[model samples]
Target: MQPTTPLFLQKFSSNAPESKELQRLTSFENVENKNRDTYLDMIRIFINRNHVYRRGHVEFIYSALKNMESFGVQKDLEVYKALIDVLPKGKFIPTNVFQAEFMHYPKQQQCVIDLLEQMEDNGVMPDYEMEDLLSNIFGNRGFPLRKYWRMMYWMPKFKNSSPWPVPSPLPDNIYELAKYAIQRISSVDVQSQITVYQTKEIESSIDDTWIVSAQAPSQKDLLKNHDLKEPVYVEGSFRIWVKDQLVNYFVLKRQPKQHIKTIKDDLDDVSNIRTPIFSFQKPIEKQVQVMQSVHEQEDGVILAVCATGTSTKDSLLSWIRHLEKDGNPVLSDALVVFTLRTGTREVATVNNVEQKQIESK
Candidate 1:
């Protein structure tokens, strides 16, 4: 004696139902009397109302499929096509539910393949937004290339199909070489010394004012190389190129023992100092600066020397020794020296000076 309009349609027509009408109709008690056609009609209505297939809708569809099986309702191709039609454009299908529903059904699987092929034939390639969603789903699940090979295989037909554009490779030249040097220096462990080499273009006219010191230099000593007439030193400080042409000047001051102590103290409490500290200071910027300096240099290799103590001297000596021991062709030919100043008297020692022809750029 129930009204003939059907509870499902009545609820669907309402402005806003209390709960999900599709879910309620598909429940055990209500779904027992509903035939396959009734179920298809419900699905169609649900799809029409909610075009976007979110996780909740996907779950609902999955439940509906299971309920249909229990009621001995056969799913026709039209039913599946309706399901695919309702799939939200540029949105990812819930992988777990998606696989569970279709992976075992040979017919449904073939339907999906045909749908993709039809899309390709009709020149309907997935746009960037859709590609991004697919990438997240596939990447997270580690989906094999062959699993979606059809999509990739047909991608070349459409322009702007590449979801992630790759930059062209850099030319093999001084700029590239400088960039590589910066990268190498930046990637080195913090406790390790950073060693960068000069390009042949800048090596020829490198300034000879650089001097190694066992201790911090005095303000007068620091400014001694400055031309008084032109006044290169601004307040007894002059900028020098450190990484390539990225200029940073050193101010004559006592060693920063207090700052180093504070930094060490702050780091001591951290369980993993390496990752937090290193990641916090992005080194890629320094590398880019080094690369940019290649075009700005007219002199020999610019070494933005900082006045530190025995540790730095030892590290430099060790690096020079390593190059010599390894028979490094580029550095082996160059003269490496250390000048120690002892109260107005200077003592110079030639570290390494073996001449060899630098390879042509």
Candidate 2:
């Protein structure tokens, strides 16, 4: 949108506020600090610069949405509403039924829809104020408004449905993250306790990292009862996500418990009152109903779950040693095998100069 002039003046002033491309580049440069305040400031500047015609609001909004994660404000409710507020009021609302059904100002409508989608993906719940704002901008029947309505209907219902409550904006520290992951995985037992161990304590340890481990009292007893002849496993690098962050965890597991699944009769059937007409049918057999803990499910029983700071074989060895040092002394005599997907179990340990490694069989 630069006027006819010598190229020097165009480069000198750049007239950033007058041109969307220049303004976007200049605004991106100005946001060097890269935090929430600086992010909101850039949005305010864009709004002020193009307040009259708002010529490039769609493009600017798109650019802002793209940079939200870098500024650490993607899940911020206030930030999203601020982006929605950029569109001029009372302008894009469709007048006729036809205008509402077919996309009016398709590009702009699509842009707002994308913004709401980002919000939804980041789990940002919209408020009534945002609904009013959307109503003013695109009326009741706009496509984005429909998305907003759908979000309103479903998001709240699902927000608190999870039995395990994890904090919003998950912690950056890997230890704290490991605690959350272990706790979630260990929820099968109410008495499960989380213990933090230091690999440095193990004199011959090489990795020198921390381990956050979770184990229940019953699991400890199970380990105690396990036969020393059968080698239990130190397994995994299994991943679970905390928001956008991926955390890999390991588990100490044993062979699956051998048992037959008994098929039960339909307790709801009330044909017991029938007389000689059904005498030939087999009578209902009743026996003791023993409830088994979910831990005894078909797959291998998870004895313990831990997330190590360094996901190496040596660190896992330290984890096993720490468990033995704790109440589970049986692990010292029991054969604990490494079954990991990340890398080989062949690892060297250092006391000072002499190192020992477990060669893969």
Candidate 3:
């Protein structure tokens, strides 16, 4: 380095005491700024991560809080709420961040009520996972009667540790609060609400009625195969019904064995053939596995088709059980088909079986 020559240069150099102090201060400011940025980055990352992945990192919030020690506690709590607000429910449970935040500052319970009320007015429902998290925060002591009422009246049945008490003579303030909460929850996820509503509609329309049976052809050949043959027919019939409608009634007794394979292969395509029909998950698999036994005994696959009702599954199982109990031949060679809204049962089964959840689009 060149030797310091000018008077001003010497004053501003690192060797100067004032210059050294300024450098230290700058370094501290840079470190502080970096720490803040790190916390913000962590919050964004945690919120944006997939639900399944986030479940594995369940301690993310605790880790983040520990790391962000520089921020004020109150501000930290607000950040936590923001993060929770954006989280999706998957295999993991949702938290009632409203209650959790209130726990840290009991005075903020009103604030939680205000937020919940606001959400309800907007027509958004919180992700399902939020339930337990909220319970953990509010427990039995904090949430008032109004909060319990909103949860009971609006939210669908889900697991909760404590029994919710019925609120009688629900106050005017509580009514307003309930209204607000419903709107707000609906706004959080309109699509989820729509899906739930549509599912219920389908459920109500179908109810618990359904039937499963084998299909048969109209006529049979009396002559032997060696003789001049007449039109041949099989005796058994394959069909299912709900509300006595022939939505997915397919019967083929004298039909070629290849018909079973044909239908199975085209299940995805024929799925939309019938109106108001719902395909259960893995339709092909359901047909093959459920009808395997019937096929062995009769050299033909039995088909089960649901006509109308949410009880197609139960009905199919009942049909199988009835066959076993009555000494009737089990038709493992059968395929089950359901007629309902397009993809309703299939999607429901997928969500119910696999714990998949809706993500914000």
Candidate 4:
């Protein structure tokens, strides 16, 4: 009924070539997909180029810094600062990530510290989390955390600030990282200068002071060794109560004497045991005492004489290795033996140690 259409036009219309519908189809599917791919590629490029968020990227930066060290410390520091600028804060990353990326080698850690110290000296305050992260990383070796914490305590900075955030669950790889790091740190004889600020408003109203008795040697004889019987007084507005004698003895043992040969030639090398005892409240005081006890009782040698759980045994061996790294001959010597505990045992004899080792094997 209609006028006859041209053959070419008829075929084009029937096949939907270059028609409104065909145009719509192309716009909806192919064009959209291509745009999405373009955006995704761009994002990938940004992340890869930044270098801080990615481990490989940061490691490469570290490598470059190491190679540049011969040029100058300032040059290396600049590289580190430039790299740190890209990494955003508050991101959840495993502790091992930092160790792997930034601290795997000793030179890398030293470079980072130098860079951070430089930044700090430049009057540009860094992100608090960065400082906390570094302190946690380098602190155990006794280099900076104690000093940093004490300094922070006195200064207006970090007073109103929230407590440093540590990851709730530690990652698995950090065990080996921490093991080696702790061992390396143990080798240095480090001391921290703690400046505590105390107010009378905080102490409990209760006046209960517990007196702990000594067993063999009485208080008078022990008094010659920085008398534990006397209440340890401090510059701060707080009273110290020596609740446990054993714990007090352990702590006081480290204090330097005038005539007796000191563990460290300088008197300043020793920590002020009086500070923790005088400043802390009850529960924290107890914790400090326990730490003191552990510090005192930890002998250099560990023998795998008895069969314990695999994890426990491995931990002991690791501790022994750490002691060896610290230059403790007792841990290194083959003469030191591990002994199983017996009923009413005072000290485990060398024979007992050998017998126990054989039985465990």
Candidate 5:
């Protein structure tokens, strides 16, 4: 015999052939629609293909979990439940305490646990039926059931908790997205008015896109009172998410005025009171000064906020013109500047905006 073989070098059974279930899932890459029906159909086919023993289910589920986003079903609870139901009932459950603690059917249990983790990541809460499925597949002591319990306890508390609630399954149209974005942005002012304008209506427009704008009545007065010589700026390629979509919006604003912060309490001042000869003291109603509005903040005063179909300079020029026509004719004399930036991260000044205005004139 050859020299005594090292224990580490001893031959072990070679790994088994590639899993057919995984191969099938890999082939699903050709699918284009990525809709719910297509995803469920694939699951049905897999179940039928492995009808008898449903072997390789652990790998199949892992593959399915990975594919959920592509199928646009990652946030869907029913799809997640269907994924959990793939496991055969009463099969992986441990009969002994030792088995339960050690993680009975380690591969299968771990696989389902990972699936539950995916659901949690996607903010998908499992329902009572999912609890029952986990109980049947991995029993009471299973880690996945514990994960499910934790999720049920926490998810509902956070759900619908946002004060600025956008519609679920956010609208696909960019105009609709822009409206929702403006609505959220305007939540700071209860009296904010949202108006939609078309660039085509602006005669000199180049980029044909919709503009959704929000401005309160107070903001309009602020614009009217704005110094005509001091140029107001169009600021931003600023971003906000309408659900999953990235929306680019711009603000019409002015630099914050530097003023001393004053906190004068009138509570101690009794100078305005007149002592009535007959009965009691009567206070004369003094004329109150018109205070600066909520829009007038330490930061720039926001005149108006808008999202345009094309966030390009041309569309913004059109937005300025639209504002001029809508009640604030003072924009006719007020010079508008642009602080638009380019893709190369270069900040562009008013040259382009001025040029566009000149060409329009």
Candidate 6:
């Protein structure tokens, strides 16, 4: 059977309002003097005038409903029903304003729950969908669910077509059970490894009329001298494992280099020392070399890695971990380190390196 279009979508025409009309209607001040019915009509116009319900319109409607009392416009049950009916389909509604406005009154609290129930009853959202949304709102806010047990009861009813019956003698306190379920649903696993290495630069220092060679500084000396025109390598390897199996691994490295120059006493002296200008090509080339060697040793096994700041790295790691939780591939027992800044670098290890699995949620 063909599914029916959701009522929220059916109430509106596909044609969007002209830019001038939308601009005028969106200004809440323009309708401030109008009666409550006019405000409700404005909401209906905003919903029906657009082909797709814009988030702004939904937010505006929510804002108006929340501030109806302050605006000296008492909203009736009909108005609340209309607002619920016109809510944007398949989108998250910001609940802060609504929660603050309605939380003080028991009747208003029931009204908000009723509106959500109506949306589910009208086929706008499935049972599980509504539960997920409500769970986020209630669970995150630490709202007591004793009065909203009906909502909690609705959670176990929909099991994605499982033939198994609901557990008999369900926990006496279903709210606690629901909270646990929500936590499990929302939890995630993250696996990360950070490797830091010290590097040194081998170069020559110039003096007046003389080219003097300087011995390469040790790692300790390079770290101590921040003004040195040398680079230090910080490499991080992140692997996300779910359900006790490795799904993804990421490799990243960064080198910080700086150069300093001194104005020679005699510009005419070609041998005079000049400030060093650092180049990143060496570090990049060395990283590429290490990657190539690792790939060759592993027979072209490739792990996805991105280079960015710590925030982006964390976001990607979290996103990949949350995507899927079941996989079969075991993490390989190989460790690769690219220490281009220092000589005698160990590029790859086949069996020498130990493999550890990390799970984050």
* C-alpha TM-scores of all predictions: 0.24, 0.78, 0.18, 0.18, 0.75, 0.23
Task: Write candidate 1's Cα lDDT for 340-360 as tens digits.
Answer: 222221111224333233322
Residue pairs that clash (backbone atoms under 3 angstroms), model 6:
188-360, 188-361, 189-360, 189-361, 190-360, 261-275
What are the runs in model 2 whose C-alpha is more than 4 Å off? 1-21, 24-31, 50-52, 260-293, 346-361
- Candidate 1: give the clashing pairs: 205-299, 205-300, 206-299, 206-300, 245-293
3 versus 5: better TM-score goes to: 5
Q: 147-261, model 4: which lDDT tens digit per residue?
A: 3444444444643353322232323443332322222222222221111111122232122221111111221122223333322110101122111101110011122223333
TM-score rank, highest first?
Answer: 2, 5, 1, 6, 3, 4
lDDT of 2 by residue, 1-361 (tens): 8657445234424244466654654365456788998777667666655355577788888888888888889889999999899899889889999999997778888999999999989899999999998999999989989989999999999999988778876777988888888888888899999999999998878998999999999888888888877878887889987667789999888887676545466768787565768577776666664555556557787789999998988898888888888898887677677767744553222212233346555
Off by over 4 Å in 6: 1-13, 90-361
Best by lDDT: 2
lDDT of 1: 0.37
Candidate 5 local Cα displacement, residue 73, angstroms: 2.5
Clashes within 3 Å, all models in order? 5, 0, 61, 0, 0, 6
Which is the better candidate, 1 or 2, if ranked by lDDT?
2
Instruction: Tell me the whole-model lDDT of each prediction, alpha carbons only.
Output: 0.37, 0.80, 0.34, 0.31, 0.77, 0.36
Who is ahead in lDDT, 1 or 4? Answer: 1
Compose the digit string of candidate 5's lDDT tens values, residues 1-361: 6775334223211222335544554345767778998888666555544344577677778877877778889889888888777788888898989999999888888888788888777667779999999999889998788888988998899877888777777778888888888899987899999999999997767888889999999899889888866878888989998656888889989988666545454768888655578656555455555577788888789999999987887788888888888998888777676767653222222223435322111
**How many Å off is the CA of 180 in candidate 3?**
25
Query: How much is 199 displaced in model 6, in angstroms?
Result: 97
Report the candidate with higher lDDT, 4 versus 6.
6
Tell me how candidate 2 scores on lDDT. 0.80
| lDDT of each residue in 12-124, candidate 3, tens digit only | 44344333533333232234554554455445544444343334233444444344445432233345455444333232222566644455334334445554554444323
The prediction achieving the highest TM-score against the true structure is: 2
Q: Which residue runs does candidate 1 get wrong by more than 4 Å?
A: 1-10, 14-22, 50-55, 73-75, 93-361
Q: What is the C-alpha RMSD of each candidate to the true structure, in Å?
A: 25.3, 6.5, 25.9, 25.8, 10.1, 25.6
